[model samples]
Target: MVIALPDPPLLEPRVLGVEDFATKRGRKYGTVLVNAESHGVVDLLPGREKELVAS
Candidate 1:
């Protein structure tokens, strides 16, 4: 008999911490979650565009 493996858990949208954001953005840059105060969600723009900003 063969056993079946369960599927991986789906990723929920949320504000990424410093390290996580950097990895996802593919660069070491400063980025503050737009909803850092409340929902803490950081939804990337369409096409995964990167933006530079001065802190």
Candidate 2:
């Protein structure tokens, strides 16, 4: 028997974070991290808001 994996969860547009931002910006994961570090933007991982702030 074989099992199939479910599709990834659909994310909204207003969300901000590394993966979402990367997908929106069409950038690689590492590139997003580097740009965020250089620009002082929070490098937020999914569901983790340690460095996020209201803008």
- Per-residue C-alpha lDDT of model 2 across residues 1-55, encoded as one tens digit per residue: 2357775564333434443344546443332222432344344444323353222
What residue runs in model 1 are displaced by over 4 Å at the alpha carbon? 1-4, 20-55
Candidate 1, residue 3: how far the Cα is off, in Å: 9.2
Put down candidate 1 lDDT per residue, 1-55, tens digits, no spaces. Answer: 2357775564554544322245545555334435434545454332322543212
Output the TM-score of candidate 1.
Answer: 0.20
Error of 2 at 18 (Å): 6.3
Clashing pairs in 2: none
Overall local distance difference test of candidate 2: 0.39
Candidate 1 lDDT score at position 2: 36
